[model samples]
Every structure is written in C-alpha cells, then in structure tokens.
Target: MLAQILPWYAHAAQRTAAAPAQALTAPARMGWSTHVGFGPGAEILGRDLRGKRLLELGCGPGHNAAHLAKHHQAQVTGVDLVGLQVRRARSHYGHIDGANFAVGHALHHLQATEQTFDAIYSVFGAVGLVAPELLLAAIARRLNPGGVLAFSVPHPARAGRHPSTDDHARESHVTVSDLIRLPLARWEFDAHRWGAHLSRTGLRITSTVDLRHPRLDPWPTTLLITARTR
Candidate 1:
C-alpha cells in the first residue's frame, strides 16, 4: 500500500511547494475546491465558517488546514492516514494556533473523539479512501448537530476511461476492497446513489455541485456534496 500511495504524497508535496508562499496567509474559507487550480476562493462550505471547530477528514499536506487556522480563524484538526502527509502538515503548520495534525484513519478519529466538531470535510481525501457507509457512519457521530459534512469525489463519469472512449456516459463501481489502479481507490456514485447512501447513514442530503471546468472536456468532473447529520 505504501508503494502504491507514495506517488500521491510526492505529488501533493510538489503541489504544496509550488504554491505561492503567501497563499497560507490568504483569507479563510469553507467548503472545498477539489479540482486542481480551482483555488480556495471557491469554497463550497459557504461563508459562515470562521471560528468554528472544523475537522478535515483527509487533509493532504495540511495546506487547507493551515489556511483555515491562519486565515479563517477556524480551530482545525486534520487527520490523514498517511504518516508522511501528517509530518508534512505538522512541519509546516504545527505552530499555528488552532491547527494540528494526526496520523490515523478517519473512522478511528471519529470513533475515539469525545469532542464533536462544528464542521467536518474532506478534499479528495478520506471520502475517496474509505467505504461510504463506514465513512458516513463515523461522520454522523463526530459532527455536531446541524454541522456540515462536505466532501469531494472524482466525477464517476470519468473513472476508468481512456479519455478517447466514445462513451461519455459510462460509469464504474469498485468495492472498498477492490484493487483499483487509481492513485486512491475511490468508489464513485451518482447523485441519486449518493443520496441513498447518505440517507441510510443518518445524514440528510443538502446539496451537490458539479465542478465542471468550462475549458476542460473529455475528463471526469469533480463532485462536491454537502450534507448534515440527522
């Protein structure tokens, strides 16, 4: 697993190093900009996240968490399954007042935490790593009442395609145990399927956004879904 996932960490580190040094000092925002280069300015969590206790489910390299803690004033705790990623985050932002990083499975953190968060979100992170049913079960218990659970997953419509495939509507599904060749083994589902899964997990579906770039085509779009615990 380490061999398969390390490439992703390397890529994240490169992206982090390539980002402007001043971005960490940029304004705080909620939600996620899952696509590459979309910017945090396009937050999906809406405009009311400041000072809230926020949890990032799969905080890669802690850039977003650092931004929230430094710029948004959010009391942020980030958890990543990858130890290196956690190290990267702590090395960069551990000194920030309201920001911390933990290396563990998201479900473990949720299961063990006595403290409930005001908001919980993942950015192309845990939501794509774990099974949906299991992920949502923990999320429901960890989030405060009426708190937000927002996450982004790859657009299912584009998974496993050659990009030159004539079929634009083709879709695929993978079980949690499946060996997927993608950087992260993500299980993709349509909006209706996601709604059904979230409903069963005791989360009320609030909204979903299709993150399609106007200039990009023949590639999968990113899907951002926002829900709340029932």
Candidate 2:
C-alpha cells in the first residue's frame, strides 16, 4: 500500500501547488459525489450546526469545512494527509472564523487528539483509503457520546467493472484529461457490510443513501453512510 500511496501523495502535492484558488469562498451545496445533483448534501449532517464541533478526515482543499463553519456556525477542523493540500486550505479558507486545517493521517490524528468532536465526516476520503476496522475504531474513540459519523465511498457495484480478487482494497487510477494518472487504493463495501462493521464498532447505523447518476445508471455511483456512536 505504501508503494502505491507514496506516488499518489507526491502527485497530489504537485496538483495542489498548481491548482488555482476557488472563486467561491464556500460551496452553494455539498454533495456526496462528484456527480452534480446526485445524493443528499449537507443536510445529512443535520440542519442546524450552530455551536457544534466537527472534524473532517481527508479534507481536500477544505471547502466542506469552510461551508459548515461559515454558514452553519460550526467549529470545524479539516485534516488532510497531503501537506500542500492543508496549506492550500489554510490559505484560501483561513479567513473563516470557525474553520482550521491540519496535516496528518486520519487514524493517527484521531488516536492522538485529546479532543473529541460532536460529529465527524468524510466525502470520498480516508474512509476509503484506510482499513475500515482501524478507521472506524479510531473514529469511535474520538467521538462524543451519540456523536455522528458520516462518509461516502465509491459503490461496491462499480467494482464489477474492474474485477479484483481482494475485496477489502482495490488498486485504481484517476486520469486527468489523459495527462496525469494518479494511482490510489480504495476499499469498497456495500451498505449491508458497512452496517455490520459499524455495529461491531459500537456505532448504530442511522442512514444509507445510494447516489446514482442522473442519467439513470443501472448501479449506484456512490454510497453515503451515516452512523452514531452508541
């Protein structure tokens, strides 16, 4: 996994440096998938976030955190594995009063932090990169009682397009305009499996939403799950 992840981190650093600052300070809507107009948005985290403490894992560029902080009045901390991404987040969203960014591995950050949060979330982020057992346990430890955990991952059904012997993690690559291919690994699990895993971690599954393409794709493109610590 290190062999695959190291290169992707380096590529991400280069891309982060070259990427231009977003014109919008905060997103108009927060969707689970990259597909526009698919799945529920920030409403999954609850309607009112005033005075809430939240943590985002693998918070690339920190738009979600900024949105929660700016519009919802939440105290949001966004952590990314890539240093450059965290730096970019601070540069762009630092003006926001309630949002902050840091660089660290998700599991390590959760385990090391003495603070606990009222909610934790990720959008196609560390939940897919790290082993579910380890990641879920770390998250549970850092969550306050009845705290929420929400995340999105590529649907397991999508894996049928690229068959893999290993069910836990699959090697994949992202192509950017046929110029750059960023190699990465993702762990895909259906809603049933996710429910079982979350239960074992002492979290109760509250919601699961399958995000399909607007064109009516046969299989869902993304899966969003929300759970709460017991």
Candidate 3:
C-alpha cells in the first residue's frame, strides 16, 4: 500500500505545487461533486463542526484541514502516508492556529497515539487504500465511542475496467461488472459488502450517500459513508 501511494502522491505534490499562490491560499472545496457542485456547499458531513477534535486521513496538501480549522473552529490534524504531501501541507498551512499536519500511515498513527477524536474523515482516503479489517481495527482504538467516522470511497461502478498493464495507471476506470474478475488492489465495495465489513469493525453505518460527478453520469461516483463507533 505504501509503495503504491508514495509515488502517486509524489506526482500529486508536483502538480499541486504548481498552482498559483492565490488559488493555494483559498480553502479547499470538498473534492466530491455528489449532488451539488464542488466545495462544502452541500455539507455532507452534517453541520456540527464547531470545537471538535478532528482528524483527516490522506489529507493531501492539507487545504481542507486548514479550511476546517479556520472556518469551523475545529482542531484539525491532517495525516498522509506520503512525506512530501505532509511537507507541502505544513509549508502551506502550518501557520494556522488549529491546523496541524503529520506524515504517517493512518493505521500506525491511530495505534500509537494516545489522542482520540470527536470525528475522523477522509475524502478519498483509507476506505479505498487500506483493507477494511486493517483500517477499522486501528480506527476502533482511536475513535471515541459514538464518534463519527465519515469517508468517501469510489463507487463500485469504478471497478468496471480490468487492471492496466502499465504500473503508472492510478485508476483504471471501468464498470462494476468488470471489477469481479480484475485483480485490483484498491477496495471498492457495494453497499451490502460495505455494511458487512463495517459490522465486524464495531462501527455502525448510519447512512451512505451516493456522490457522482454532476456533469458525468454512471461512470464514476463515490459512496459517502457516515458511521459511528459502537
């Protein structure tokens, strides 16, 4: 998993660094299109962010953490497995009073830290990258009881294509039917599979929202899941 994401995010760092300072300074828009356009305009995670202890997994460049700290009064810690992404986030948003960035794998951090959070979230993070059992075990330890865990994962429809021969392809887009035979590493789950996976993790699913690109239909979408620690 580390081997896969490190190079991918290294590429992301180069791409993200080239943006204008003004654009970088602006708070991050929620990366999903889902129902509405980009940004947190739809408030998919609900509206109770004030004074919460929040952690964002796979927070590339830390823009959303900075935004939450600045606007929502949340004490935010953003972690990414890749060091370059974490460094970029620190360089960009380290000055913010409530935003902190760390470079570490989420599962390892969750295991080692004494801290617990009111909520934990990932836009397109652990739910896809790590296996459910591994991720949930670590999360069960760090998330406070009844704490919210909100995350988004590529909809099962994305698994349509067969895995590409090229090692460089980050995402090989295809339909859900094609995914059954392909030997892909990323975990893309249907609602039933997701429900079963979470049940064993001591996390109870409260809702699952389907988010797709507004302009693009059926091909690529995300399942935004909100769960609570049991």
Most lDDT-accurate candidate: 2
In order of TM-score, best first, we have: 2, 3, 1
Model 2: per-residue lDDT, tens digit, 24-141? Answer: 4876667788685566878888778898999999997888898889888999999988787787788878889999999998998999899999999999788878888999999999
lDDT of 1 at 194: 74
TM-score of each: 0.76, 0.89, 0.79
Better of 1 and 2 by lDDT: 2
The runs of at least 3 residues in candidate 3 whose Cα sits more than 4 Å from the true structure, single-residue gaps closed, are: 20-36, 39-42, 159-184, 218-220
Ranking by lDDT: 2, 1, 3
Question: Whole-model Cα lDDT per candidate?
Answer: 0.70, 0.82, 0.70
lDDT score for residue 59 of model 2: 92
Tell me the lDDT of candidate 2: 0.82
Superior candidate under TM-score, 1 versus 3: 3
Give the backbone clash total of model 1. 1
Runs of candidate 1 with Cα error greater than 4 angstroms are 1-31, 34-43, 159-184
- Candidate 3 RMSD computed on C-alpha atoms after optimal superposition onto the true structure: 6.2
Write model 3 residue lDDT over 1-230, tens digit each, in one string.
65656455645555456753332452744554344344243155558778888988888778778888877778999988888777778878888878998988888878888999988888776556776788876776788877888887767665353322332224422222323322336666666666667778888888887665656665656777778887
- Superposed on all Cα atoms, the candidates' RMSDs to the truth, in angstroms, are 6.2, 2.5, 6.2
* Candidate 1 lDDT tens digits, 1-230: 56435555665555556653231432344445545566334255547667889899888678778877887778899998767678777777777889989988888888988989888888877875676788788888888888888888776665443321221223333222234323434566766777877888788878887676666655546778888877
